[model samples]
Target: MKVKSVIVPSGMEHLTKFTRKIPSDVNVVPVTNDDSFSNIPLKILHPSKKGRGKNEDSMVLYGQFGLKSFIFMGDLDRRGERQVLQDYPSLKVNIVKLGHHGSRTSSDPNFIKQLEPELAIISAGRHNRYGHPNQETLNTLKMENIS
Candidate 1:
């Protein structure tokens, strides 16, 4: 299938080079916090204010699929996670894409407890240099009974 558009977080200058690399024929749509699509269940959820680092500026998305809900955390660290919880205290999900590749810096135990996700997804290379999928994070998921 032919790719059509690439949606990304807006107002981040660092992404300019990345966006420029996209094929000219494809549409580049930049979205910000709380932005929603018409007739779609997806919505962007990132901190609006500038963060201390690019990782903190990562986008978090919430979407609903039928009776299930999911939250996608894009490289957000503990600080960003705290802010998100403060902004949306009632937020809950059935699935979660753990932030920062399941690094210790991102998945705070409290954050996991609050979300109570049924499943957690950690994307990382098994032999990555940074040693991702930290044991602490795995312990958190296991303690929470998340698969």
Candidate 2:
């Protein structure tokens, strides 16, 4: 499968390892907030407010192939998600991967409502230390009628 990932420094090493394990023929696109790696093509987004001087924490992966668009928010919190929504008001996506393991820090109600995705996937380990898949986040999804 063709894959596009939002590159954040916190997870780059892990991402690189996983991407290397993928089949050679598959296309892997790494979109980042900064141009840290010279070898890989990068799409740099707007800089953060703190003047981090680079794309820090605001990024959402957009995967488009044929007629489908899938959006993945990697560890993105409410602020990051809001930035994305504000930047792209008319954004339409088929699938949404909940950020921060569906923690309350991510998946704001308004953000979820705006996406209106057909499928919402939450990737979190069961009984995680953070108590992920937070009840609040799940309730917000249910309120929006998203399964």
Candidate 3:
């Protein structure tokens, strides 16, 4: 199967190491603003605007099997999501992996409204250090009727 990943510059080190554990048969596509991995088929979703110093822009990856798409926000903030919405006005997706584990720093009301993804996944270690998936973020998702 083909696998696509969006890696913000700051997360590359960890992601790179993690990727090594995956099977070689999978085709991995990493999207990022870092030129260091330029030779590795990086897709730049936002080029003009400066994203979170480490290139924090909202990225969309189309699934190889179907028309479904997944949007990955590597610690992207509200502003970044807005920029993405503007960049792709007609953007739609099947799933959205919430940025920063649904931290209050991200997930703007309008951004969530626009995305309206069928499923929202927040990748966070259960009851770790930071209190992620903050109440406000959950409320926001509930307000938008997103599960």
- Best candidate, TM-score: 1
* Poorest 10 consecutive residues by lDDT, candidate 3: 56-65
lDDT of each: 0.85, 0.69, 0.65
lDDT winner between 2 and 3, please give it: 2
Considering every candidate listed, which one attains the maximal lDDT?
A: 1
What does candidate 2 score on TM? Answer: 0.66
Model 3, position 48: C-alpha lDDT score:
35
Q: Per-residue lDDT for 8 in model 1?
A: 65
Q: Candidate 2: which stretches are off by over 4 Å?
A: 1-58
List, in order, the clash count of every candidate structure.
0, 0, 0
Candidate 3: tens digits of C-alpha lDDT, residues 6-101: 343433334556568766665544334433353443245443333334435444332312566777776777777787778778877677788878
TM-score of each predicted structure versus truth = 0.85, 0.66, 0.64
Question: Which digits, one per residue and each the tens of the lDDT, describe model 1 over residues 29-52?
Answer: 666776778866677788565443
List clashing residue pairs in candidate 3: none
The candidates, ranked best first by lDDT, are 1, 2, 3
Candidate 2 lDDT, 1-147, residue by residue in tens: 455443443333345556577666654443344444554433333223333212235455666657767787877778788888777789777888888889899899999999988789999999999998999999998898888
Task: Choose 1 or 3, whichever is better by lDDT.
Answer: 1
Q: Residue 96 in model 2: shift from native, Å?
A: 0.1
